[model samples]
Target: MMGNRALLMNFMEKFLETVRFGNNDFAVIAGYGDVVI
Candidate 1:
């Protein structure tokens, strides 16, 4: 469980980085955020 949580955290970090730096579509990112949540 801990390992999975840590991996999730790492993935979230990178996902946020992509949201911050990536010039992708707002709808797509928002969709991903909704899915993640």
Candidate 2:
């Protein structure tokens, strides 16, 4: 399992990429699912 900060950091990185690519659906689905982009 990951720590809180690590999880938050990971989410932040992915969030940025999501914004860059405009993949809002991916961002929402990725919250608890392990779907690779």
Highest-lDDT candidate? 2
The TM-score values for the models, in the order shown, are 0.56, 0.59
Off by over 4 Å in 1: 25-37
> Taking the candidates one at a time, how many backbone clashes does each contain?
0, 0
Candidate number achieving the greatest TM-score relative to the actual structure:
2
Residue-wise C-alpha lDDT for candidate 1, range 1-37, written one tens digit per residue: 9976886776677667667877457646754775566
CA RMSD for every model?
A: 4.6, 4.3
28 in model 1: Cα distance from truth in Å? 8.5
Residue 11 lDDT (model 2): 78
Q: Evaluate all candidate structures by whole-model CA lDDT and list the values in order.
A: 0.66, 0.70
